[model samples]
Target: MATIPAKYFIALVPEGKIQEEATALKEEMKNLFNLKYALKSPAHITIKMPFEWNENKEDKLIYKLQKFLAGIGVFDLKFRDFDRFGRRVIFVDVLPSATLQSLQESLGKFCKLELNLINELSDRAFHPHLTISFKDVKPKNFDLYWKHIQSKHFNADYQVRDVALLKRMEGRWKVIHRFPLTEA
Candidate 1:
């Protein structure tokens, strides 16, 4: 059987206040980029890029992730402004704080322990953005999407209790397990 690749991502999903604002932005995306390509609810700040793995190997991957995360603890994240990449994507920009940076660093080390030490590029240094839009978007709709998102600013703060192991199943992504960060 053809298998899907899995990834490990740590994120702070908008809980109370941020969820409300993200909902509104999602609605706007429905009109702007078309709902099919945009990400679903519970918008968040990603800690690591999606890691690739096969379904048959998922069990080992999960165990590796669990052990790696055991040494780390929870952290806080703050969301700030709406920004777009060219005209294809929209997101909530996170004010890169020292705490967030440290979390990313720690997660990177954990990933290296679990998997191969992939070369992380300088430009790919975690900037901490909450995705709000996506690809296959039209140029004409950029202004319309921007107007709807410009005035909307969400500064919701949330705690990062866990990291998720996600797989691209069917035609979309789904979480296989969420590993809580705990004391080593």
Candidate 2:
């Protein structure tokens, strides 16, 4: 018999209304630009980037995450307008926040020390944004997409009450568990 490892990542995923809004934007991106890669996962600001871990050890991983995350205080996030990573990516712009940075840094350190999950992606500066489009958008059409997206408006205030651990299941990502934020 053989076992398949599960691909996992942690993120602060807001509730229904925000997800619906983000999903709609993602759908619009696919329709307008013929790029659908962002549709693979729900809109989220990544806390711990994807890592491979043995499925048999998942319970242990979840337990540690639960313990670590429950001590963190819940915080509010403000997102206003749209921004891009050069021409390659367009996202719902997140306002500058110190609390968000602290949460991510704490989670990153915990993942490294406790879960032994080291992600090269996380090594980069933490920029929190709910992506609307990335990678699949053709370079030539970038200006067009940017022009189109700029015409669209997205702004919201969301509270982070819990963090989700998602597994890359089947073909797309699915939330397997949520660890709530508790004031320390």
Candidate 3:
């Protein structure tokens, strides 16, 4: 018998009202732009790009992440304004912070060295944004979508105290585990 592979990614997810607001924005994108892809996953800022792993080794991944997160301290993150990656994607902009960058870089390196995992986006520069929609955006509607979102200001900040591990199942991403960030 052969085991099926599992897909996973790590991210920082906001809680309380911030999460509610982000989800509302995503819903608006779906209703206004007819883009449903963004609704598949909860609002989040990606810390690690999606990667594949053996199902049988899932416990090992969780164990290492637990240890790794024990050393990570809480950091403040702010999402302010709207931005796009070219014409295909729209997202809420995350203010640049050294703490966020260091955490991402450290997590990336740790994944590569300790877990022997290499993500597809690992080579590219990390641009952390909570996506509203991606390639599903129609070319003709790009401007309308951007203009609509850009005109409407969005700003929120929250302390990031945990990183979530999401797994894909039934065509939706589910938060399967959360690793608590140690107090600074």
Candidate 4:
């Protein structure tokens, strides 16, 4: 018998007002533009890109992540308006914070050294943003959507107290574990 590998990623899932605002924006994208793929998962900033591993080794991976997060402290995050990667994707802009950058870098190093998961995408550079809509937005509609929401305003500030381990199951990504940042 063969085992199927499971996919996982680490992310900061927004809470309270930030989550609500991001959810509302996703709803607007669905209703107005008929784009909804980003809604498949909750709003978050990807600290580590998706990586695959055997199901049997999941416990070890989780243990490593817990240890890594235990050394991190809660950090403040702020979002404002909208931004995009060319015309292909649109997202809520996350202001660059040294704390966020440092956390991402440390996660990349830890994943490589501890889990043997070397994520080139996350390792190369990190552009932290909360996606609003992508993958489903057609090229023709990209401009129209971008233009319509370009100037729309949204502001949210929240503390990232924990990191979530989301696993792809049956095709949907769901939060399987949460490791809180414990250090001051």
Candidate 5:
């Protein structure tokens, strides 16, 4: 029998205080989303998402990551507030900033040119966000969920020093590599 393929997601994880606030926010989201399972650790702003890859491909992916990250430098990021996306997904919207927009666009291009992962779910044109809660919620519950989430607010900010490669294994996500975005 063929094994179920593992998935990998790359993200820019916030360090220190912001990480803590985001963690707390996850609790709020869990309740609002009426989640069935526990949330994952290392709350972050994703740059790339679930892609099929083998364990042996780590080094090559890292190399590609390094090359793509070259010329790109560290930038600040702020997790402004919580907002639900059509009731199915919950995310913290990031306030627009040029640094953030450039980074997202560049990464989107690199993911296309280097990794060849197609399927653009979001605008690479705008700054991206950190997903706090997601579930396959029933349509009837959508308004109930959004109304609950509407009253809550999340305001956390942090400098984005590094981005990471996270791989899912044995039913959990693990950070495989963290590449720093150096000062220009």
Candidate 6:
């Protein structure tokens, strides 16, 4: 018998008004550009890129995350406008904040030390943004979509109180566990 691998990533999910606006933008993008891939998951700023592990090891991984997050304090996250990774991708830009950067660094270290997961991309540096369209975007339509949204305005501010563990099941990613950051 073959066993399935468990895929997971850590992210800060936007809430309240921010979430609503993000969702609306995603819908518009899907309709206008036929970019349905972006709708697979809720809007979120990724803290750690996706990694695979044995399904049996999930409990241990979550335990380590809970302990690590317990000592952190909540901070603010703000999104000002839209940006892109060249022409292939478009995303909501997250303004740089010291607190958010520190949290990401701390999480990366903890994952390396405790979970034994060395995320090379996150370790080198952090570029925090919420993706609106990716992967399935066609090169032929990239310029058209990019030009339409490049100067569009979007703004939202929300508290970064919890980091969620999203797992891929079937073909879509879903939030399986959420670890709240407490005032420490």
Q: List the residue pairs that clash in candidate 3.
A: none
What lDDT does candidate 6 reach at residue 111? 79
RMSD of 5: 3.2
Error of 2 at 23 (Å): 0.5
Better of 3 and 4 by lDDT: 4
Whole-model lDDT per candidate: 0.67, 0.87, 0.87, 0.87, 0.71, 0.85
Worst 10 residues of 6 by lDDT: 116-125
Residue by residue across 46-108, what tens digits does model 5's lDDT show?
776578865566677789988887767777766676665665776778877788667777777
State which candidate, 2 or 3, has the greater TM-score: 3
Candidate 4, residue 132: the lDDT equals 94
Model 1: ten consecutive residues of lowest lDDT: 6-15
Model 6 / residue 131 / CA error / Å: 0.6
For this target, which candidate reaches the highest TM-score against the unseen true structure?
3
lDDT of model number 1: 0.67
Write the residue-wise lDDT of candidate 1 on 89-129 in tens digits.
77888766886687678768766766664637621567778
Candidate 3 wrong stretches, greater than 4 Å = none
TM-score of model 1 vs. true structure:
0.79
Error of 1 at 94 (Å): 1.5
Cα lDDT, model 6, residue 62: 88
Candidate 2 ranges beyond 4 A from true positions: 1-3, 119-121
Clashing pairs in 4: none
Better of 4 and 6 by TM-score: 4
lDDT of 3 by residue, 1-184 (tens): 3776989999998878877888888889888768889888889998888888887888888999999989888889888888998999899899999999998898888998998878456435899898988868988888888888877788887899899999998989989899998887
Candidate ordering by TM-score (highest first)? 3, 2, 4, 6, 5, 1
- Candidate 6 ranges beyond 4 A from true positions: 1-4
Worst 10 residues of 3 by lDDT: 115-124
